[model samples]
Target: MGHDQVVTSKGNDHPGNGPAVSREEFDALFEALRTWGRWTPADRGACNRVSPEHVRRAADLVRSGTVVPLARPWDTEPGPDNARPALHYMSELGDAEAPEPSVHKDFLGADYHGKAVSHLDALSHIAYRGRLYDGRTAREAVGSRGARFGAVSALGPLVTRGVLLDLPAVSGEKWLEPGRAVHAPDLVAAEEALGVTFGEGDAVLLRTGRLRRRRERGAWDLDAASAGLHVHAMPLLAERGICVLGGDGDSDVRPSPVDGVRSPVHTLALAAMGVPLLDNLALEALSAACAEAGRYAFLLVVAPLNVPGGTGSPVTPVAVL
Candidate 1:
């Protein structure tokens, strides 16, 4: 779909999903947004935009010195949202053989790419037309071990200014209802409402109040319906030169605006734009902090586990102000 075919926000009575698009149209979009061969290390993708100066500027935003973590509790319970719940079990329950001193131990693991765990997605995590971010062949780049090109280890320790686009605050709704598509207009309206603007190397976070909804109501199938960016919003974000993009719903509106694409935003940001993604972040506390501070931007830090060749990592990102 083109700019003319853009879908408005939930308030517009749009069909939730926008116009039906052919594979050719989606390919046109993919080609238009690509940033291949722009940087020396292709795996770092748009993360290269964040320089040391950006980090210093971000740290300057820490006025109150209050910190808020963005990851939800590591979910071990089965729910409608988490099909494969993360594993947490005691390896030793205060019964180590070290004299009278006992030790407590546990193991943690998860297929964190799903709707449950808050995680950061590297460029190799998504492929379009059999290729990764720099058009490297996915089959060859991703071996039996993990991604050879865009490993999570490559994009290490992202620190940048973060902007929270809290749509519910602008709409006066608890959350954008499931299956709603957030558009460029919605982002602009949010920027206007929150007194923040997208800037170079910024970590743009879209908060649809998914956690608040789940806290009040219950878990619904995100595959069926979820509020997130539509493909039409990519051009604006790309022009702003975002270093990272994230959201509560993996950054794609469900029943995708484009036909035959389940996660168009992922394809656009990761495969096309080479921008890493943070999925399933719990932004309620961050939202409240921003509102309390009367500002939406803050110093955001993402330190993913240094997993070599891993496509992504479970992360506990934090916002400070």
Candidate 2:
């Protein structure tokens, strides 16, 4: 769809102090953003936007050659948001019988579909109204064997230009308060303030200083309330043709502004637009790097494990300036 065709959330206010998104409104938005049958019947989804030309343009962003890792540490402790903790232990610590080579082996595991782990969510990770992306029934597409469509294996290494919209930097706030909603106007103002613009085939990362808040005040119930994009902001991103969207949070503001939908942004981006998401990222270092360089755009590289039929995979994305 063209930018001119982008939908706006203007008159639909909810009963509470949230965006006025009724079930009907959300359904309309979903239909407007749906990309069913737009590409070949495949699981890669919106990632097809990143052509070879896009990769070459992204490579041009690497000037200073400084690398920044964007994955939060594998958290093994449970918290309010992290219902399941990651696992880490040594399998062998140089205690084996006499051998030519000595090795210290470790095991790591996680139920990564939670708040603690940094992971990529494939297009099949979410389903709306008992249907997966491209109108595949959830029952038929996802079973005990795993998703038949939109598996992480179909989404290989992602190399593209990443645009960081550091909201805290623009607003001069230590962090946006929890339950704050980042709307479309905020995104426009942030781009103007940072002198950065997003375009087609870009990976947009939103930073609300989540880590800084956690450091200063300690962890809270993130699922209860966290700063992130409101569903009203989806059209702006859709207009820009962004393939990947991510944030320090799971990219959805909590206590969902959308009526009846828990994760409206997730539903719109993945189930509707066929866009993938990078969840639970650590963007503190990226924020500092951008401040130092006076630039917010860089070459981003994310390689998820090639787990066939898996809903998602833990990942450590890197940004090169």
Candidate 3:
């Protein structure tokens, strides 16, 4: 169905099956993964892990020259999760009385910091305990003008090896049900099953088959419940030295396993590890492409808009196999 045509119902909360994490436990994990002051003063955050050598190596993975675009369509209708659907309307239409030449124009806008749009979250996007990555106070770094420290402009263009951890494919399931928590063990199992391993400078994308589930079962409140990584999985990702983390959902399993926190993974990845996140990606086509090619790793490139002082940018990342 067209994006605007999908009807949605109140989303059920997916209180994942993982053990509850106390505020203290969550704080400990945050401290353990924190990369504050690790790199030079910069807005790229963990993206600095990707170097020229990494990009060269990633380019070597493109053997079949297959390209997959990992962006959901610009949703123009609101749903339980998409409170602000993208706007698409004609701005100008050709008028016979105007002149001999005719042209058509349209406009587009979105409050993309939601579940419907595919977007990248800059380090400035998340703040924990009143501070951002690199120990910048949120109030001091971000203001009405935008972010001064972690703007998307500092993260120029991202080029690295992309790893697709297809959980459903590994488990012989079509999709992991909402409220399902993917822990460290799941990552290890998926790596073994897919014959792929995580490494530094890699963009790890976890596909829980969210879109497929919605297509088959109809729309529900995604904010209330979604299949994603638990806070327990952050250590593995940090150990692997990933620069980018993305998924069909926002990368956090909900209702958050961490007590008193809404998006623990977001906090861990962005505020603690300084890793940027690609949220709300449409990874179904990438999964099919990987399966057809018999490989899960690819050369991934993402170029966010150079919006100075902006928190993040809407992006259409591309993966080549």
The TM-scores, one per candidate, come to 0.94, 0.94, 0.95
1-321 per-residue lDDT for model 3 (tens digits): 433132222322334547888899889889999888888655688899998999999999999999999999999977776888899999888864677678889998998998999999999999999999988999999999999999998898899999999999999899988778999999999999999999899999999998998887766676677789989999999999999999999999876787788899999998889999999999999999999999999999999999999889999999999
User: What 10-residue stretch in candidate 2 is worst by lDDT?
Assistant: 1-10
**Candidate 1, clashing residue pairs?**
64-321, 179-226
Taking all chains together, the TM-score of candidate 1 against the true structure is 0.94
Q: Over the stretch 186-296, how does candidate 1's per-residue lDDT look in tens digits?
A: 899999999999899999999999988887777777876788888888999999999999987799887676766768899999999999999999999998999999999
Q: What is the lDDT of candidate 1?
A: 0.89
- Runs of candidate 3 with Cα error greater than 4 angstroms are 1-16
Clashing residue pairs in candidate 2, if any?
13-20, 14-20
- Cα deviation in Å at residue 71, candidate 1? 0.4
What overall lDDT goes with each candidate model?
A: 0.89, 0.87, 0.89
**lDDT (tens digit, per residue) of candidate 2 on 1-321:** 111121123232322225667899889999988888887645788899999999999999999999999999989987766788999999989877867688899999999987878899998899999888888898998899998888899899999999999999999999987777889999999999999999899999999888888877777777667788888899999999999999999998776876788889999998998889999899999999999999999999999999999999999999999
At residue 167, candidate 2 shows an lDDT of 96
